[model samples]
Target: MSAARIFAVMVKEFTQLTRDRLTYALILVMPIVQLLLFGYAINNDPHHLPTAVLIQDDSAFARSTLGAIAHTDYFDIVETARTPAELTQAMARGRVQFTITIPGDFTRRVVRGDRAQILVEADASDPSATGAAVAALAGLPQEALKRDLLGAVAPARAAAPPFEVVVHRRYNPEAIAAYNIVPGLLGVILSMTLVMMTALGVTREYERGTMESLLATPVKPIEVMIGKLAPYVLVGLIQTVVILALARVLFDVPMAGGWGVLSVGTMLFIVGSLALGFLLSTVARTQLQAMQMSVFYILPSILLSGFMFPFRGMPDWAQWIGTIIPVTHFLRVVRGALLKGLGFADLWQSLGALSLFVVVVVSLAMARYRTTLD
Candidate 1:
């Protein structure tokens, strides 16, 4: 390329970028915003998780154990449950994240030099939160037992079995972060690339006056939409396969669920993303504006979709905002399937949400799309 040609192209590109205020703002502001949000707002550590106590044995030993747990700042005793059924109900309603059920015979068994069993039930929907809570609880009884055992036996024997801590990492036994994040990134990557590509694709045709020529042909609106979406759907599938393969080979991430299920889930996500792009294209007057709209949509999808940050860590308002993004639902489905090996029964809500989004967005785009530019 000649120097003059390169300079002209550069000038055109800079002018295009300058014309799109949203894209310019996103390019300048998104990185800083993401850094601040992810650095300060996202914490993997779970603290002061709400917990219910069912202390049937209200003795010195039970009280001591409860005190130890409470003093550690890990468990906030929100309420007292009278029965296991009540505890279960509380957990199901998400009123309590964990429940400590100290059996009626807890003190009697401990005092009699017999083993005492305390049942701990934790909601593991948010794996990071559940893991931290479980770890804190696991150390409690052991510390209490150590204190008691040391007083009984001088310098505690070398082979002493003080108290057994059985930790059942619910939902995910291994507690792998990649198992959650990798699948979620699939949705994020697809939404970011596919939406931008499609949005710009139609807008570019409009900028070049090619859309008019194309519409003058026999192609119907729906047919045009289909033809435009088809190639990007294939691209989305290719990206999915590459991501899955990389996750498996490089990250040792297991495909715990069937590929068929993943394929369908990914297709739904792509449809939603493409529909969003098409909608943006209908409103955007130029390719630069289309790109800007894509960026405006993508930033929230990345930040709020739980791709780079833990969803539970975000504030209630932020989480509610996240619920509106198509990528958020897609992430839930992908992560649930890939990590938890969740079936259709487990992921039906997410899939249903994506389906609804696709319908709404595509319908709006079709309605807005005019064959004749007025």
Candidate 2:
């Protein structure tokens, strides 16, 4: 109603906003971070995807065909497998996205026009990452042997394709998006709820004038931290069960691996998330700041953690940053356990990473709590 009063209130509010350094930084920094992540880091049509090759044939045609495949800029041959078992292990462990197997008599069969086959196996769990690479293969059979089919094999080149590209889409053979997304939701949901909830719960004590009473108590910092986080851990696990249940019943996502591995990984991630929340509470002066800090963490986790985009699709720097986030490792564990039928050996690195995150974050939260006391 009063123009002068309205102007005064607006000035006061702007001053208050600038004084809240965390919120001010969030406002200024979040947009820049989002722009960089989306512009530079995110790539749906990923190139140089890791590939493994098993060349049973040592002939010129085999070599020529592989040379053509490599030049596509889609598949990067990172490993050479001696046997089928090794190739299987590579895919199982998420080492390679595509595998090429040139049969023992590929050259002989191609020269004789006997419909020689080159086996191409792809990890189709995350279809978006593999789609372009797989599509690149369709043209390879027609174009790969064009040069080698000269002279005696000239007739071979003209007879349809010199070789067949037999593609086997591993894991989610149907390339169902739900297979990738549903399992990832467990990590995302747990990270969102557990971190925000734990941060708010502790910050609420300070807001409600209970923190002074808590400080007056005889309980130690570690004891208080554990007490605050324990309830949220249970809540996270319950959310995990509910999400997994809906994933199976609604989406029909496969639970391929053992429950034991999923259980251990889930617990580690939930605990780590709660520890991170506690750490944020130590840094944030109010519930709003705690919530903002949580968003700062959650946004990158959703983007760079391969929840929404392909992890391998991101640039090396983004991937490196992603590895430091617990959600990235948790997503791997969940997807491996649920979709790939991955065992402890296949998932050890991710599990170990999650374990390390829990230890480091909990230790940092404890240290931050000590600082809060001071």
Candidate 3:
């Protein structure tokens, strides 16, 4: 109850905090990470989404329309697809958010006052990302051909409109939030649970003095790491099954892709997450420190991984950082396989990224793991 006793206790706590360098660093670093992510990385209104154009008409009018759409800062026509198959592959692979098909006779039809339609196909898997961009398309019909519809085509502009912009929202056409969220939740949940559980389980061994027995065993470091993580892999798979089942039954989330692709992706992500957790266990001295480290890792995984925010909406630098996190690639795999029916050919890069993450994390964990009781 005394003032002197209270002051002494506070001084002791400050000393203890300073001694625990990892905890002290987390205290300062966590807030900065949160601030940077929210302030710079997280953007609801993403612009310049990658778009592909199947320009069958090599006319001045078609180019003018594209120029007008690009001027809005909503779509960036990155690819020129020669055929419908090319455009379909791009969308399936998560390469482009939108595809515009300008028919060969579009300019001819527009000048004749006949029906001319510009097909705008959007990958609406994550509807929030597509909503603003789709909304921007409304005015393109009125403004797109303003300059091109001059001279002989002047009367066409004054009519109903020069050409029709037929917006087809592909995959989750209804803009259902649950369709996007449920699949992403699988990654977020696995990242949180697998990482935290593995870190804590290993750290617990040290606290209970069981780590000495583990050190006494002549098992190789890689062997020990794999042995410890093997059980958690099963746990992760079980969780994935449960979540996906609920997603199908309750949320009606479509599983458009093959089970084989999803299975490979799920296994890769689970092992990668457990490997990261093992890495955290090596750095943290106590169970509490391990838990704190897991949270630090999970925060960025949830935010930068596109689990909660629009991935393409993030600035270039932020997107670069997001690419380094495993969950970012895994989310693509899950969402792609389930929603778009993307095959191995379409998702090879993401699968490769997950494999690289597992290798890097497991190597780091092996190097950090202590060989002796000392």
Candidate 4:
């Protein structure tokens, strides 16, 4: 508790921190990055989501309902389908996020003073988007019904007839929280494990002088990188399998898509996350520093990646920042595949973004490692 001793310790700590260029850069860069990401990208309310209408009735009443939805500014009609099969195909292909179906007897039912049925199907894999779509659909028919009721009813003590709202919440139709959360848990688990593991892997070798000894051998940097990465890649796969099994067995989360696509997407996500960790490791001189840097990167990823909060609710700036993190795209791919039964054609954008992340992060890590090796 001596003042002199405390001052000396403080000085030593400052000297160590100053000598570590990576720690210094992280301290400087992390705040700005996190501020921008938190302030701009996170949004809970989303508008103008792409929607489709399948009008089998195609009558005045059907057109009125469609016009009401379209004019609300909540949805943009991207396509129209005349048949139910065609509408199903569009939903399966992820061409439309929300679908509206007006039964063939809609106009006749309304005219006959009977309740008409409208089927609203939403991709509930993304809860925020699904909720917004459902809310819009729920209100649309009610408003139309109210307007029609007012016109048909007597001015004195008019009573509204009973109507039914049929909401088909597709893919987690029950709005199971586990179905939404479990798939994302896989991404979060892998992000934490892979990034921290790989971040420490290279830095620990350098700190212990093993990296130099390895470099002295015939192994090239690329080979060393691959060798270092191979084991963790397997670890990532193991984690994926474990999580998938738990999700299915314990949580009853359905795997509607092919296992092959999930496997490939998981591997790609692991590679990208591992590369990002390796990049951090190349810059970090100590294992402790590497761990801190990994945390710094991971914190923002968890917050902004639509893991805990809804991505659609986030502001544009926050959403943009979330997009930069590999976890964001990975979550989309995993959840979309696992819950929505979506295929590569539907998730090409996320897949492509993950690929880009892998390339850029791995290249940066290699470049930095090369400089460190030389």
The best candidate by TM-score is 2
TM-score-better candidate, 2 vs 3: 2
- Models 1 onward score TM values of 0.72, 0.97, 0.96, 0.83
Q: Residue 332 error for model 3, in Å?
A: 1.1
- Would you list the rank order by lDDT, best first? 3, 2, 4, 1
Between which residue pairs do clashes occur in model 2?
none
lDDT of 1 by residue, 334-370 (tens): 7666655666755677878888998999999899888
List clash counts for every candidate, in order. Answer: 0, 0, 0, 14
RMSD of 2: 1.2
Residue runs of model 2 more than 4 Å from their true location after superposition = 371-373
- Per-residue lDDT for 1-374 in model 4, tens only? 79999999999999998988877887898889877767565555666667778888877667767777777766778988877888887777566777888888886766655776788788777666667656766566556655544455423113233234588888878788789889999999999999999999888998898888887788777787888899999999898889999999999999888565677788889998988888999888799898988899888778888887777566666768788888888888888888877788778888889999999998898888862465
Q: Candidate 2, residue 349: CA error in Å?
A: 0.5
The 0-to-1 C-alpha lDDT of every candidate, in the order given, reads 0.75, 0.90, 0.91, 0.79
List, residue by residue over 194-232, the lDDT tens digit for candidate 2: 999888876888788787888887878889988888888
- lDDT: worst 10-residue window of model 2: 365-374
* Residue 289 C-alpha lDDT in model 1: 76
